[model samples]
Target: MMGTSGGSEEIIILSDDEDDKDTSCLIVEVEAVKKTVGVLPVSPQDEDLVVTFSRRPDVLPHARYDCPIHPFMPTDCERTAPMANNELICDQCFCYICDKLASLCGMWCCSGACHCNSHNKSDFWNDVRNTALLGELQRFNLTLSEVDHHLRNADTMLQSFRDELSALFSSIPLDQAMLPDYNINQQDLSSRYGPVLECVTLFLNKADKKNSRAAAIMHLGAAEEFMRHFQVLGFMGSSSAATTSETIIMLLHRVISSVQRRIVMGDITPLFMQKLQTFYQNRICFPADMRPLKNRFKCFIFGRNLSPVFCSLTIRPWQDVLLVSVLKGQNVSGFRKDKGKKDILFETISVVLLRTELLQLQSRYRELCRYLRVVLTDNTTLYQHLQDLIPFFKCKLGEFGSALESLFPPASPPASRFTPPIFLLYLRIFETATAPRLTVSQPEQLCFSGASWEPIKDAVPLKRSELVKFALKAQRCSLPVGSDPQCWASLLKVVCSPHGSPTALPVPSQQFLHESRDAVIDLLNQQGYNIQISRCFLKTYPDQALLLLVTGALGVRILQGSFSPALPVLHAYKDNLWAFQWLCEGMTSSEDRLKSFLKEITQESSNT
Candidate 1:
């Protein structure tokens, strides 16, 4: 008996002398085969490669070495005995039974069986092939179904969002004028139409979670579709046009409210907020004409506390035009040609007021401070007036102290001084006792910055009878008794000779002479002046028709010697009628004092 020890196992071979010799030779051959097929020790760096199993081991089917099975097989073939280890296979061998590379087939060089040349009809090999093929088909089917399910879900969500959007649009009026009140309740809207907002939010959140480009594209498409629908409804018109659609405005309110809520709750990231802001600026608020209105709306929504940041994002610099117009109760048509923009302005103000009423005391204080800052920066003339007006709100001074400090901190640089029309308009709206004194030489710098010929351009031709009436009204109202009979006579001859009886005067000549006397009278009445004052200013300043039309007076003392005082006021205000009108409407001083002030300012400007 001979024994051999391999690791922990001991093999004992009992044989006759001749048999023992053959067994020893067989053991030597087995040891040589094991040495030839042994696996190399894996290095630490190659540990990952150890787990990488090849599923497609038959990828290279061509022979790697010369063999009898190939085209160069010799007629007389020498065949070597199969090895006793499954891992040992000739490079050129292939398993016919497994339909794979012989090197990858474990049974190809098995100790008791070699399947490299096994017949295709073998039952054992057929079962192995069939099991693998069935498993692959099953996996492919599951993968395809998963893709289909995801596609269907996406379609369903998109359709649901579309339907919800349609419902929300249907609830709001297309025209703002149709609404009973301009104010919209954000909470009420969220309660009633929250699903629409939630649906959009859900899509955005899912896209973010999945990091999916397709999902992101889908969200963008939906947003575009919503905007397209708005345009189709005439709510988002061209740059030169305007829309009063309550639907779009309310939609904006809801969207902004939702986004703000999400941001506050930590449901969205700053990156997402930035993207949304960009989308709003580029897509919703890009039009040059609509910029003023939309910026005002955004400014109101963000409130005064965030004004600094919001102001930077605004498409244009902030202006108080809308607020001034609204406070003055001026007709929307007087401010802008677009009716839609007018409605939006009113609506935005209405919403701001409504929200103010509902806010907590601190919030209201912040809002007050914001308004104070706006007045201080844009309409410095009204800042003190607002301080006076603040008392009427019944807010305690102590409560606003903190907010005021934050807005105008100690030793902070003073706000840039400006004299916007709002300054004068606010004074008029509040009916202040006197205009604020200006430290700057020309507080009305913006007023005289450019020339305007609108008075001449807008004049209408009038009949001879109308001219006679205008002349009579002017003579009765403004002419001093027995002072200028020759002046009246000359004016009448000049007025009557231009056009015969019942003849129409040329528009340009009549503009200089009359300039729509009736309309001027109406405008004067609108500005709280009586018919006598209107007719007197019109008749006395027939040569300064542009001045009369703009300032509602000759902008000078009536019956004052020399037109020098009037000349300065006219020169400073002729082109900027809008600002001049605001100043005139707001002034509580007598005509002479206003004229003196204009002369002083003009002198200061010249000296500077």
Candidate 2:
């Protein structure tokens, strides 16, 4: 201890006497000068490092003993940056540690360990980072080139069973292939792969930006292949990469984001074709009959937040194929659903938004009652926004429920179930590479994150004004929009058509939607009523019929504690249980297609 002795201290005086010499000799360490001590002696086989000092009793006494160091002789005063501020506990990315790359936050990723004694900046270590970063860049480029090439030249990339999934995930070597598994411990890794993981972490961390958007697209293709290979070969033997939840999340995000970006670009890449091939094969994402895998929540959260771009893409034909993935209770994605196996579906998105939007908004407030009162006080935008989403909300509900049935059919496994499967055939045709060959009847419906009618009346001939007036009047006066001469003709058609119960308008096929819409408008104008999907059933049928019919088909038994039932289920919420109301409505299909569709919907609702 650096302490001062209080009171009187005795001072020793040197004497020339022989007795004095003996005392002086006792004060000196005989072994200290004779022995050579090492800084740190480490054996290749053992991580344990031994730092030894000469066995000298005299020097040991004068060592001050605060810390057991040798006698003062310029003892090293080891220190690191003052323990980072209690409030400033930010951790640096491995890239910052290795390659000196900055985080999305424009600063070099740093941590207490950045300059730790255990691992510090040495020329050798510095060279290791620089060299590894170079290889990482090269690997990045190589995988990028492979994905881009495959996306362009289906001829070469999609040739065999092996050359698929180059879009969603990539196959970069650990160049210093230290940790073959993602779960390798930091100390266990080649001290090089840390930066690589950091680079990946940065990519996965970003939320809603363009740069991160494109990379995920390319990675998904490769991930698709990697996962498939994992399923077939069981090559890695339950290592973290093979079974971690985080890896799976990253894998799905990459594929989903890639498809979205490529589709938006209107460029059909080879990976797209490969995906089509895979779809037709009814191949499992992970091989069936493999050992069960556990879920990794952290990685899934990262992927979920990073996946806005992927989430926005309206999966027309693909949802039918992808939803078949019975979300293992262990492997659910971003959606915060408890029933993971059945919960994550496109329809489940509404549930997420409902929970998240409120939670996020609430986080910004101190008191719930004050905020609730504020919301109550303002009917302005809040009420209007809610009103606008009504039509869109209904569609989401239907789509979500429908997704559950389509995706998770009971008593059927993925691979063996699709024999002469028409559903598989449809997906393949949609995914086919050569050219756009779509049947008129097999029209692909385009779902929307937003709604039509109110939002999209600009496309209609009669101004948005006239349409709204009719809808409002229908609502207030209890008159079908079709009952008025201006609105009556259209109302009758929707009322007369067997399937015309309109709790939700159908997601119109892109090719046939405009024509159906035009048919609806014309029918309204000519016949004083209309048929087909519409904004409100008031123009066609009474409120009772529409509400009862739609709710019945939904088949969701409402749970007691729900925030909002009028919601859209993005892919994650497909299996959310709604407290459904059922009726004993007899839906017998007579002769008409409309009648048959309605009847089928009704019958299915009751039977289920």
Candidate 3:
């Protein structure tokens, strides 16, 4: 109960006695119950008012709540119901208090001043509300921390490749002029050159005859494998360019020494052995070319110059010949200009001198046609003829004119790489006849869309090569996947850029930057990376833009809550992944620190 007048005043209550002398008025002096000193004098009425209604009708509104002129608790006087369980509460300020003290004091008065003018605590409402809000806050903070950490982690990952390439380039001294233009670390030298050289040494030593001879014989294959490996590692030059091999240099000398030693010993077979070794040397040394010389020494040990047995048009054992004898009597007349000069097409039998190996010939011929197709820009008819030429290379040049007319069909557009002829070739080369095509039941499944992943359902049966092609297509980048070109370009941009900053890429023209940036983004996105780029990305700095774009996109995606684990993508591009560390050398101190800082941020962010 609160009095209408302010300040510490006694309340006068009129008794309900029916005596003649008027009901004796009772004056009640409300004193502070607590004996604590220095208690400030407080007004009986509080400023803040809270009127609460009871669910039960038995509970009446206090009399102090009613007043004339200053009605409705003056719309400001503090008023509140007792606490739950019927605990005593201050009539002026709704603070909970002991029930026994409330009865003794005549009103539910708490220790706090009744007329205190201050704000009220509004935090607690319901247990459910409190729990829900707290939990949500915690979750939001955690997610933010996780996102921050992942973004940095992605930056570090991108920088790692850069670092690797840098380290590699640094290992070679400036004075080393004899080294290749693109020499990796000494380890690469050891990795590619070591095994072969070790084998060569064994071949040279007569005391180690068992190991040496075995290693020499196996050296050819090992050298080939390592050459391909180094090439994949971005160590080799172009396919057409010749690279000096340490193993080959040592092996040639070793062969010469062996020849000299055998000649001194008066060995009868020394000359023949020298010739055979020379042929093997030539085969290993030359790059693959559309020349019959490469295949001449393929089976040199079996005697390449045994005899020239001509079947029809002087087809020799030494010549790259594919003998075609049709059961039906028919003359081979439809001759390509290039084919006419290379082979003789006669009736009943056609002796085609294929300059390359069976598989190599097909590949070279197809590549030549493709190159010409792109160059001429009107080789649709020529391309169709080339498609038919695959079977023709295998000596099935039957009904050539009809086959060409049917395959070409006059004015039809040039067929895509997905044409039946190419697909059939891929099936023949890469897929086994006994193996079933991949389906939903297959072990490996490619992801095209992140939201809804389904097994690629093909109308025709799917070969492994087709699956590979589809996977590449799903990535949506013109850049070669899991290849050295991608790896080399990825690293080069960072290293070659100004002060090793991706954003500091040099642009030839300012106008091309925005267009190039979008293109770079699209390329990276196709490779399943989301990145951000400034409008300064230019076609001139594509390599730099690519590096920055991928790194930026990865960070953006990670921070924006669409992060997929990077390890899998890195693994898919393992060759490129391994190249990252060397690439990092081009980075500035800040960039290097940024990578380390990101690692620390993840930890600190999680703690927060």
Candidate 4:
């Protein structure tokens, strides 16, 4: 048993036999061990110290901080020391000589520090500096090598493209002034001209046998068909058509020459010979009723007389009737001023005359009317009745009144030679006869005094002619999908100007309007607006301001993320509200305010 005393207190342990004796020896040894290794005292402040040790510092110190080898070394110390005449220093955690950390330093590593001592005179630092800078150089060299390879490839491709383009240009025919003369056969001619020759032959045979108006009309229609064919085949000018006509005339002349030769050789029968003789005999006989037909036949034989034939076919009958009834005074009662027959005759005459001949006929008829007024002065009723006919002609000719000034003597202004009088008349008729009536409802009257009122009232009227010209210009500017950027920009500038008012803008055609609307939609979509917004813009704005509004919307969309001021949030904005507000506030607002607003929105967007 073993006993320990603390402050005069003693304790003893008893064991059985030899086992107790061994236990006492073990206890004594344990007491001796406890005295050799003492326990440290612990306090509550120690827990705080442990926590502080475990926490990370806000900022980390430099690698050189508290370094044992270079304790006085600054954090920003250079590799070379200023002292000792710029001697090289090894201050890094990694040892240059050993090529390892300082903790792993050993004498056997890198053949000890004998090489480290020779740093000042050795080429080791120079080699290391070059290696450090060479990494970036290597990367730059790789990039430049790749760029040079691509440049060479691009040069080769460009040269190949140029060679291909040159070959293509060389293969294309450049001479457009002279087209090849194709050798067309009789079948090809018939297919191209469409029975015009047959009509001409039938008319010739009928005229030789009998004096008939049907034959004359048929020949006139055939001539018209021939002219139409010439136009379709790109014989645009009168000279071109006349030149082409020579070939046809030569073909007909050959047939006549062949017939004459056959007759000389006695190739025809007796009955055919008698008919041919009678046909020739009739050519010399000039009956009064057959004179117009004879004149038309003579004109047809001579290819150069084609224009006079077109005119004479329509004018000759009327000229004969007027000469016989009015000038010769043979049938004065038939053309009596009071009779409705004269009116019907005049109407028929007007309908048959071509646009080019209308002015000439009008001047001639006006002169005749003046002559009748003087000749029938004794018969006041007949004279007054004849005077009444002048108003009908005036009313019928009113549609071409604008052109009449240039055609007649007094004022001959330079007019558009391309525009036809019939087209102009059609435009006038559409504007007058088919124009939409302005019927104001009660709700419309109340909205009349709204913000759009003053601008609509002050808007200038655009002429139909101007609208047509603008549409043609826009068509030229348009591309397959949209329009050319520069061309569209110029057109927008013109329409957005003060002189070009939106109120009176005319639609040239439904197709043109649709295409223009589609172009505007495409432009808006390209500018990042959604399809609904693009359609809304089109529905909200007038046609004249379509391009202008689109351009403005794009500007606003860039700055404010919406097409207009009224539509601040594109997704949330109502289309109905956009239409109503845009017509009022958006259109009536001054340009300066809009510009300033755009500028502010741009600044705000940039700041955010």
Error of 3 at 429 (Å): 24
The residue-by-residue lDDT of candidate 2 on 394-445, one tens digit each, is 2222232222232223333121122222222222222221112111111122
lDDT of 1 by residue, 145-168 (tens): 223333345445656666777877
Candidate 4 C-alpha lDDT tens digits along 178-217: 2344543445434544344444454445433322212222
Report how far off residue 377 is in candidate 4 (Å).
Answer: 38
**C-alpha RMSD values across all candidates:** 29.9, 28.2, 41.3, 44.6
Q: What TM-score does each of the candidates earn?
A: 0.21, 0.21, 0.17, 0.18
Question: Which one wins by lDDT: 1 or 2?
Answer: 1
- Model 2 residue runs over 4 Å out of place are 1-150, 153-184, 187-220, 224-248, 260-388, 391-608
Lowest lDDT 10-mer window, candidate 2?
434-443
Residue 404, model 1: Cα distance from true site in angstroms: 16
Model 1 worst lDDT window (10 residues): 309-318
Error of 1 at 422 (Å): 34
From the highest lDDT down, the ranking of the candidates is 1, 4, 3, 2
lDDT of 3 at 418: 31
Candidate 1 contains a number of clashing pairs equal to: 0
Error of 4 at 383 (Å): 36
Specify the highest-lDDT model's number. Answer: 1
Please give the ranking of all candidate structures by TM-score, highest first, separated by commas: 2, 1, 4, 3
